[model samples]
Target: MKKMLVLMLTLTMVLAISACGGKAKESTTESTQQPTTKTEEAAATEEEFLPEPGAKLVVWSSGTEKVLVDEAAKAFKEKYGIDVEFQEVGPDKSIERMTTDGPAGVGADVFLAVHDRIGSAVQSGIILPNDYHEEETKANNSDKAIEALTIDNILYGYPNSVETTAVFYNKDLVPEAPKTWDDVIKFAKTFNDPKKQKYAYMWENGNGYWNFGFLGGYGAYVFGKDGSDPSDIGLNNEGGVEAMKFYQSLKNTVLPLKTADITSDIKKSLFTEGKLAMNVSGPWDTISLKEAVKNLGVMEYPTLPNGQPMKPFSGVKAFLVNANTKYPNAAKLFANLITSEEFQIKDFELLGNLPSNKKAAENDKIKNDPFASVFLKQFENSVPMPKIQQMNAFWSVHEATFTSIWNDGVDPKVALDDMVKKMQDSIASSK
Candidate 1:
């Protein structure tokens, strides 16, 4: 199965550390020598880290971020005398698409992806570890970002940004953001109107991404040991069942609607129209929400019913080097260069993303911006989504399990236990 999957994902990956490597190592010899030739100078600087001579690389970038990639490509070409081609591929779809494209030799040499999907990329054997720049990467970026991109101890990503959801409320309806889930519940008493399609609070109900906060606050995790142990599932544990019970209870009292009826579009429309009082959304919604509502406020999420800090999953976006690339050295260099402090800041300025670079995160613009500030604070308590292949299956199971409990009256424990079993079955079958 492993071999078949690799064949499905990529044809061959030749990344010889001896052939094309990383930074110049610290020389211990006392004698000093001068490099005479251009090749010698390049080797002495990178020492073994030089890119393949005349190497050109292809980079897969999202259409929205193509300009940034173009900038990086231009800078790289000027510095190394190698050209780079920019190809449009949605960052979210890079991993799956590479599975077929990579083997055919048309895939990117470098690509951008969210940290959560690193495991699938690794298991498919289509990407190279960030072996060349690991040390400096850790020193320059946030530890959590580094941790998120590492799968089973291998550094697979060059960190770019940190993202997580936070509280967004209408200042007219909510004088102050709710400090607890109970606070949201209390406000619902006077605010809910089933016929008018108005509600005090609303979120994507069945979506595991948002709902995971409750499970986390109640002390349940998806898989044990930071998602490395597939055998130790935690969704059916005591905390998980309790979390779902509270999640189930909120159905009628707070929202007064079925999970399917509360789509994100409807919620956004209601919030903008001044009907919905509050919402749990990410930073991406900042501009749109601000345009519609005069008094929109953003803040860290309120504590859960159990009094635990909201643990929404923090997602780190990263640049990954493809293993199938002909020029591993050039690919790694390009990946590292694009995620440097300069580019990170540019990404923030142009895209409104929160940079993973420590210095970039400390910039006054991000610190002073209310919406960006909230997500940065919330990231302190947030957990990265599991970096395991099972997560690909876990999302569907989570949605199914939560939907059944919220809509069908299924018992939380029974539903969760079934969820665990389904996860195990899926993991086993995938193997």
Candidate 2:
């Protein structure tokens, strides 16, 4: 099934590219001829086609999301009489496997994916185009969450959860959350003790995903605001260089550790051990942090020195139906059921995931939760991570650029300029 879909997609692309070349005149003539009204009506009728019942369905999710998907599957089975199976598959591995399994007719009917993967999945023809519950989904989810799942103006998935990094502080060490970057720097200067392994704040500064907040806060962005224009790269601009300079200054000034020393494991260990006062992380750390720290407090990311809020990249996790699935209706139903407001609220209660559903987010339980509220506030200032395939090239370049500045002592401007050039080259090659 997936193989056929890929073949069709490849042929479509080939024809499109060819049409732009020597066949432009012929293709234009064919395209300009309007379809008959009867033909259009027939296409509309076919769009409403539904799959048969009693088809067994399989779903894949990460281990952390297993319980949520399992509960959803149970509810879906009861309501629709469709037998559903749930499997633990990490998001990255799921996308990778779909490239092979989908084409072979053995892929799960539904699978979880981060919003950023939508572009690649669509390009590969692995995920189906969603035409179910469009209005309900738009009305229920946050605009950014909805935007995340949209590729070239078509919805591809049902958003389940939305996440962005925020500041998590140890209440015992910091009486209150720092309000601004300068405040954080001052607090770090007074609180950090390299000799005692204590620090005021720490994050994986070398990681571009985490560092993007600072760059974005200062008017630097990976692409344009809409994230569609790859030619307008912003990472090496004046604001970006300034952000990098600030990031570089932290290594030996406010932060006692180097960028290479701030791996996620090390950061988690330090924070969990009460040696770190504050750490920038996402919801995935909530459970472990709560268990390790007696008094854990969450807050919106601090304001930058320029008085602008730190703009983290928001990532939406959604359920995507396999394009090649035999049970299209069942898969769509299951996807819709799992991302519904009720299930989103249940997921929040069970796993502390921040729901993409606006109604679920407005529930008293989530609205009143101190930890959850902070993330909600941060989301207001966050930017959706770009869904363009060019973004795939951006990640490695971002990492290398930051690593050079922080670890290799390369000049920030030089590193950024080189990084952007490399990124543009990569984007061209990817095309």
Candidate 3:
């Protein structure tokens, strides 16, 4: 822990030195301004936050909606005269790359990452806080987006979209979404035909993210209620073990393939072809699934066997400025711009993503959107993926553990205990 703190301090010093010139440049812009009215004062204020001289920026995002970035970049150039480039980078990999590529000055000026990874980014000191636009961001975006992007009291990301898993079903086959996992199982008994590549339900069954949907109760969680207490892992608790047993029971009754055979692509292909009835998926797949299947319907997660709403992981994808960027001001400007209500609306119109901005969510199109609305409802019951660096271990440990329990028929209690121990050790080593 001390070594981590030292690294954070060292990186902070480097960013501080690099950004010190920004205020001087702002002051230089301010001195030349002779403002006599509030309008001019506002204009000066906007102009005063200037980027470094001749600074250009590259932004990294998943590229599903590159057009959104392109539009934002166009407006950004109009305002700051800075050239902004959009680069394709998966949010998951982008979070990892910031650890190595960012400090080396080879990463994008601003990059998109899932909010859960904020802990790693902040602790590494490779990303700057959303200091300049924190107030605006908070007032515009949903509370969940704000909370997910914040650590301690500091906001670290410009909120873009919020997502959670939900059960998507073929309306033609099922008519209504399953009300509970039991409903899913009952339907599976009659609907499943492995020989015909058909099933009543499908999902990334063995994946930790999917299994996380089953864990919900007063005392069952990855770490603790807020997922912040590393010492109090609850994955081995009574509720968690029960959830795991039901999880395995579902697999035993429905799908006959090994865990590895249930790839996302295969599930998707089956679902689209009407070979599968219901599957748990997020909004990213909504568009293509709707396009491929005319009767596609999405609804918030069904109630679990434990009589609680399925608590899948909730994720917020937001943009963060690279602390090591040559153009901190420009990078921040782009992040702020793209996270605005209009930009978020564009994201929704183009990609069907749930806008984090409150006004964007209130847009007529989004409010009426069938698919987006269900995920929004699910977000209420969803678990906010922990924003601690130790969550990395949770993923590594549980991914294999869940698969082992499901595929190898390992005892749920024993598997969970071993998984918790491994996760604890990984977190301790990192500390």
Candidate 4:
């Protein structure tokens, strides 16, 4: 899936003191001693910790946030006289590391990732609730952003980035961005020139994300339970069906050049080359879009015939701690430092990511940036991506089934039935 909602949990992954207690003591002692050579000590301290005496922390991140995480760690050490160690790892591996590899040794005291992983992370019983928000923090950020990262009424991560699916169009081809999905379809059917080298939109691989957005426009929801309850499935409901039908109707009209290959770069290239007039994308590609095309325009995915703007699932990336970390207090401080307005705002400006910190949004640096703010607005009505583990099972069969209906001449009813059955089977197998 192009934009499968990534869920990150606060790992607070402390190794069992018994398991690595010996190594930790040695590492701590070494971390405190000044090396004989100043340059060597400086470089080593730069990578390891520069604690005042013996303060130490470990962090795991996606590596994209390396600079930000590192700077924050450095600041924490300077301010509180603590030493911090950091590692780079993707969200999936982070989860595996926490659950299967953490307690033994070599695990992070805190983890940084997205919100969608909360269910599985919590189910794994290795994450702890966060208690860092001030009243001002909640007031500045969207309530939904806060709620999305929260599980079991306990917030486990400090939401760091805001993401949503919005319409990105070329101003050269279209006079103005359409206000609704119906308008989008109408525009595609009316203006697209297949024989001439233009398309109204591009179909990546499947319509899950697009359909998910449309379902919201029609007042529909998937998984029914806001990730807190993982057993429920909402894909078979009326809204889901309607959303699917809408996507099926667009098969030939305005899809991308490579309908079967849902790769993002390919889709962006088509749009940039003037083959695609519009597509749904997030802040991840804002910079590339601007560099690829001139006069790029953005608009909310308009409502279905029902008058609701497509409330796409917003992605929430956050910093989490490992529950098993030996340095729980230090880990909490580190998580707090990462989410602080200074580091988060700087990251938002540098990366074009919508800031998760409430105060970061108001920073003068990003207040007027069009690309950043558009994504920020999408968060207003955005729903959190469902964080169920069964979601993986559903996705495995989703593309094939969706392709069958939209491209391979399969009946919608039959296709949906197979999808439901396959998903149910996956759920059973997982249990």
Best by lDDT: 3
* Cα-based lDDT for every prediction: 0.85, 0.86, 0.86, 0.71
- Steric overlap count per candidate: 0, 1, 0, 22
Which portions of model 2 miss their true places by more than 4 Å?
Answer: 1-51
**Which residue window of length 10 is worst by lDDT in model 1?**
22-31
Of candidate 3, the 10-residue stretch with the lowest lDDT total is 211-220
Model 1's alpha-carbon lDDT is 0.85
Regions of candidate 3 where Cα sits further than 4 Å from its true position: 1-44, 217-219
Off by over 4 Å in 1: 1-56, 81-85
Checking candidate 3 for backbone clashes, the offending pairs are none
lDDT of 4 by residue, 1-431 (tens): 32333222222224344558878888889877857687776567445532224547788876666777778877887788777777888664687678875666567878876677777788887776776443434655667667776666777777677788787889988778887666777888877776775778664546565556765665555565564343566665676667667767666655634445656776777788887888778886777788888889877776666666677777777777788777766776677667777777877755667887767788777778876777788777777777666666665787787778777767666777688778778878889
**RMSD to true structure for each model, in Å:** 14.7, 15.6, 14.2, 17.6
Estimate the TM-score for candidate 1.
Answer: 0.85
Please report the TM-score between candidate 4 and the true structure.
Answer: 0.78
> Highest TM-score, which number?
3
What TM-score does candidate 2 get on C-alpha atoms?
Answer: 0.86
